[model samples]
Target: MNGPRERGRPGGADAADRALDDAVALANGPATARPGSRQPSTDPLVVALGHEPAGAGPAQARTRARQRPDAVAWPEARRLARRVGRRLDPRALPLGEDLLGMALARSLTALTDLPSFDSSAMDGWAVAGSGPWRLKGQVLAGQQRSADALLGGHAVRIATGAVLPPGTTAVLRSEHGSTQLRTDGEWLHVLASHSAPRAGQEIRRKGQECRGGEELLPAGAVVTPAVLGLAAAAGYDELTVTMRPRVEILVLGDELLDQGPPRAGRVRDALGPMLPSWLRGLGAEVTSVRRLVDDAGTLHAAVAASTADLVVTTGGTASGPVDHVHPVLAQLGATLLVDGVAVRPGHPMLLAQLPAGGLLAGLPGNPLAAVSGVLTLVDPVLRTLAGRPAPAPYAAPLTANVPGHPVDTRLVPVVFDDESAARPLHFTGPAMLRGLAAADGMAVIPPGGARAGQETAVLDTGALAPAWGSGA
Candidate 1:
């Protein structure tokens, strides 16, 4: 398993040095002018990435200086996430119809030939001759009927799925044939209007779909409804699927209420109620959601005792007085894989590998920021662990201009307009959820922001649902 640690730091010293150079260059150089324009834009990410003009502003300069040198770029952070996911071993689960949406741990093979036996594919007469014939008894599905071999002019009534009798030649449809009451008494006959019956026309032969021991589905295929039906038909009562990753959430905040309206200085525990459902949608089995105090001891104990594969902590990622996540992680001898990200509304999010073999993702307390952290880190990691592939890249033109962060990428909520362009939504601050709730996805805005009509990457929130394939 090529784990993130074993892979060495992504974009090592030279990359870091280059990032530093870019940062310094942004601080010292003048902003580059847009094509055909004399003035330069003041996008924060652009400024942070060394596109800011010299003497842009004192505040911008100070902000650049204060930026953490170790902050990871958005793309690199995701690459590391994939590495972490690939390192973990996948557990095999017993198969059942309920295992739909789970990934197959191994290829599925047929235990028996499909259709299993030759059977009638329609309700008709199993005839032995080419024309008018003597009628035998009727044979329904699942019935065992024994009769003398049909002579050249004899036939028997048969229903769909009924096994063909001995000496059966071909099936003639009831509508295509008729009963004649003649001097020879009652007789079953083929109609004159119809042409000669084609042999094997309505017979479903054994192994029509698949033969015994044939490969039915490959490993990593998602167990969908069709797959389940196929598995049952192919003689499987159980299937081996990749186990869902176990997750334990720690919602940290002393000013959060579990079941009440906001009052005084406290607010509702938004993350506690939100994380579990979203995590489950991402193919994680949330083992627990524990609310802990802002104290370092409580967090340290929880982190040390967790048995889940991933430990997600909300809030306390910053260096403020109440921020204990960093200190607790440090005390536990955890390796900080990502200290901070170059993204808006979730810049304080962090990732670490614990000494106890569990991974920890520290998300900022703000509602939208926490969501950003989930997409940036948790989403990819769980998908990899579940044996799912990464989602394909998607982009759309912007319907309006979105303000950018000087040095960080921005994930802004947007709704699709009539033109299919993504229009940025309002009330999209780090602490707000209104915009997100009404949004189709979050548009990826680069530094210096994007002008109207510019193409931008979009991350669909609906991709988190299990029905959405590998993104789930």
Candidate 2:
């Protein structure tokens, strides 16, 4: 939830801003509700210092109402975030230990011809003509090329990957050719019924796989482990790759505790410990995670000082006494892009551009709501910046009917079963995390909801990627 509007805000809190917020809040429901509760038709609450009266858990989020005519539709919100990233500049880095999962900035052209030399593709004998052939010296991989050249009908013992001797026309695989020590010399002969070695058989011709300077992979390809191997095999000691988008996390809320159990009047800070790892999986270099109390000036300083490509913040999206996020944005003359999304529990989430540099993702304070924001907004943008391609969208039938949000789309945690159907889990309220912890994915239930056996879109979180870093 958000804190109160700070004093002397930009053009001063005129009647127009208040009227606009009220209309948008009324149109969307209350600016907020209890995190996990269903949307309620109610009037906006009078908040102070960014908090609601005594017992009402902080009002959900500030309604941006007409700021966007209405909150953006769920899918559109994602696309908007992606567009923001595409507009930003992409960084490039030389191949190194940190290149894993980064995207290719340019096509990976071969530094040298693949195979670079005519070489044996299998353990065989390099021969100039059909058998029976005279056999001479042996050739093994990694040895410098022998000065001797094979003559017509002459064969030499060779190993897989060995450079083919000059004048050799074809290779006879060891299994297909038999060698015998005759009275005068060694000779190799093909199998009794087997055919003769065809020209270029069992040989890897120079530049056959690719010519020097030929493109191996196009731009925007992710750098996977196999890609690294391929790059090394192609005689490349260096590669140009897309740099991971740098991100900084700003965790706001004075009532949140980072350690131990939630002490008197304080809940544990959940997002602070989770988002960094999650962001990395979605392709981001989380530069820092800073926890700040509900102070407008402090929040302003942090966001303004940040040099990262993205600045993700928790809470202060709603108009609560301490909800300072929006006010701070206005103070800095930032452009609000996706002011709010029409997703349950995360309707207050926002995306904006900083005046100086960087962008900010304002995630709702609720645990699960914040996660929804991360999925619907953060992932697409970060992946765009890092050059990671979006996963193919797929759907599965649901096991039950999920309640709808009238005008908003819903993302419910679900577990996929052998039937390839999604079993929607309970406890998936905007504020709840129990169902999500055990879920395979979040099912995107369209507005008006989906009935049992209906195919619903499933979102991938890319959680399978390794969470890497030095120990915290």
Candidate 3:
């Protein structure tokens, strides 16, 4: 039935190619559809999985990272993002309450005005433009309004935050005034500044800095002290925010020990001491952390009963003989979201979704890889759990040549200029942790690579800078 002998090599049949195409076409249809089964709707999911197709298999992630315009490429990044979107939730709180308790656990809404009204900004005399007045009375903050009338041609001694009486348009500091007894029994003399005060001077007007209900902070903002104060000034008692994910850590490897004399070949666990502080900066509340030896059964039992919202396991994710994580995860039916990222020193890092509505990330045993995983994978997930937005990367001109493979997104440590402009410092491999500790932030070398003079985007460490002296 061959139409004609094809002029090609003996094994040149395109059967594999044809079969692949057919399989791809059928992948959009249900496997057990009957001959008379009706086609599903053209919507992506409907057409891809067919009508009534086995519970739509946990929302398919948009993992075509290569198609994205950005240079950094990590398959796990997108999958983790979608999983975070599905798992975390954000809510709002009232104005006036301090952002503590659960409120501190969530990202705050925007801020409003500080004073929220026109109030005196200093301890002074509130006077009208037509001075040469008599002493009317004195007013301090928190004093209730009384029948004391501040007449025209009179001045009132005012304390900070006091509401100005009608017709008073300016405030002259207390040092500028002279009060004296008048000859009349019922009068006291007041000499206001000879230069009549200007109207609206030293007054904080309502909505001057921020109006009522104006966003004092964008959504997904980390509630810092400044942000906290701003929110309070807006008259908010409480604010709705996204809840942070509860995390549990398990540091595995028989070569690790804690607080004991180091055995000949073993060492003290670095993760046990370092991970908690690192996790907090990502806004995650670590519920628990345990150390377990590399045993599949033991790890499985521990993970099965763990109730945390997320679990991070360190070491033992590779294919080495002692690597129990991969096998145990497989046995537990964990969905492999990311088996291995191409980034150096972090090649063994794994991101998987636990069957029980949470995520599991595995970091390599090396100190550098372990830290890299935190910055690249763990940081994003923790931010998601905290309901914070993915911060935009900071762009900077590369000061020198940064080397790396064309496919991997390299994380290089860097510092910033006084004006917050990022500048790369040293290049450290994934196995090198010294440079990372010295640098203030990490810059990403996007896939397709970069030259010494090209501009690059750096991720800044969100550390609070020291308060500088104003006079300096």
Candidate 4:
């Protein structure tokens, strides 16, 4: 099932390179100064293409902004991911440590047998042969092993997890015994109505649980509670784990206020409060958050001061009068990783990395659009940093007819029938948080796709798994 990203190369990365080169050329041109302003011509590409960066229409300026330059891999955004990932090693980190405590990323591998000792599966009498036997002393969990153990004509009481003393072959539960226990003067006697047990009956043989040196877990596994429990049982006290990627957030918008009521066209801050929780879910510790105005100078300073592995800026990514994010980013010599994805609702998504070692994800202004960018960009980066294995796709048939998209790949909210097999329940727009709340996951529809009771790939919330988990 392993394969490359199905959608192919990003168009935004390519677009950003061309735009940067053109902007650079314009910066070296004669019209390098802004009218009635002290700002160095930030968007030279717009000037050269016959437009003003401040008052230019988005369509025209964006068109002029495109000066195709040779594509360079490792755009600024990916470099951020790499920087964050550099602190952690996926393979050396133990699942136990990651799930149980705060873990720094390091390379790790399993070291011990999962189940160390051979034990019995049932509570019964232990006997060596098929012949009859007398009742011996009982052995329960935590009791010391018995010496001079004889099973030829005697049965010893054994409980689950209790070491089977030498000469024990079979375990017959008390329920199967005609007379389980009869108290005598100093010992509890058992009367066997049947012959002694045979080999391997109710007996967990040595190395059957696990060899002493066998591998209990693989590298790059994100530690969960059960994973930790397994490692602990395997006698591991410390585990190496991928260090959590550090993240930084910058909410850009003149209309947004960190606190206080909206005045006129302004709105309450949407990004600052929401980003921390989302980053945590992706296993990242958000180190800082900054809010910047729509001014190019302010935006440039914020980008320059950013110190996290990944810096996410909201608003000003698309073409707008106040949009100075792309221009400021170009000026910083940040490589464009992905300027736009071919997906609906999050097409304006921007990805880049500064030369100084950090990643940047530019999200659209709409709350829904920003959420899409987090899932599409941030989630995968965190996964890569943690060294977790790529997850297999979850498949479910569409509950209702889903509309097709001719131009862009679609991420549709879906609910599942957690009571049985996971079944898909499609919902409305990316903007509809209520609709997403009712969903168990996001279903991916390929570009130019249609569906009617057809199966689709789902990015499940993982809550759909049965409490015991799928046996697979």
lDDT of 1: 0.74
Instruction: Give, for candidate 4, the lowest lDDT window spanning 10 residues.
Output: 1-10
Q: Is candidate 3 or candidate 4 better by TM-score?
A: 3
lDDT of 4 by residue, 37-140 (tens): 33235443343233332221233223323521221111223333333434454334434433432332432343544344556678877766654456767788
lDDT by residue for model 3 (332-424), tens: 898877677656547678778888978888888877688777765776666556655444333454556666554455667766556443456
Weakest 10 consecutive residues of candidate 3 by summed lDDT: 1-10
Write down the worst ten-residue block by lDDT for model 2. 1-10
The TM-scores, one per candidate, come to 0.77, 0.77, 0.74, 0.69
Compute the lDDT of residue 127 as modeled in candidate 4: 66
What lDDT would each prediction earn against the true structure? 0.74, 0.74, 0.59, 0.57
Off by over 4 Å in 1: 1-68, 86-94, 127-134, 144-155, 165-205, 416-421, 462-472
Question: Candidate 2's residue-wise lDDT over 33-151, tens digit each?
Answer: 44555323332223211222111222222323333356886666876887786533555555556777677777888888888999999998999977799999999999975637999
Which parts of model 2 are misplaced by more than 4 Å? 1-69, 86-92, 146-149, 166-179, 189-201, 263-265, 467-472
* Backbone clashes (count) for model 1: 14
lDDT of model 2 at residue 467?
Answer: 55
What root-mean-square deviation over C-alphas does model 2 reach? Answer: 13.1
Give a tens-digit lDDT track for model 1, residues 1-472: 1100000111332343233223322222223343443224544323333233333344443454477576777665766775775534544454465576677777899998988988889999888867778786878899865555677878888999998887788899988999876786667876789876788878889899889999998776778778888887787778887877889999999999988799999999999988888887777778999999989999999999998889999999998999999999989999999888878889899999999788999999999999999988887678677775543334567788787877777889888776667889999899999999888778877656777876555676643466324342
Q: Considering TM-score, which of the candidate structures 2 and 4 is the better prediction for this target?
A: 2
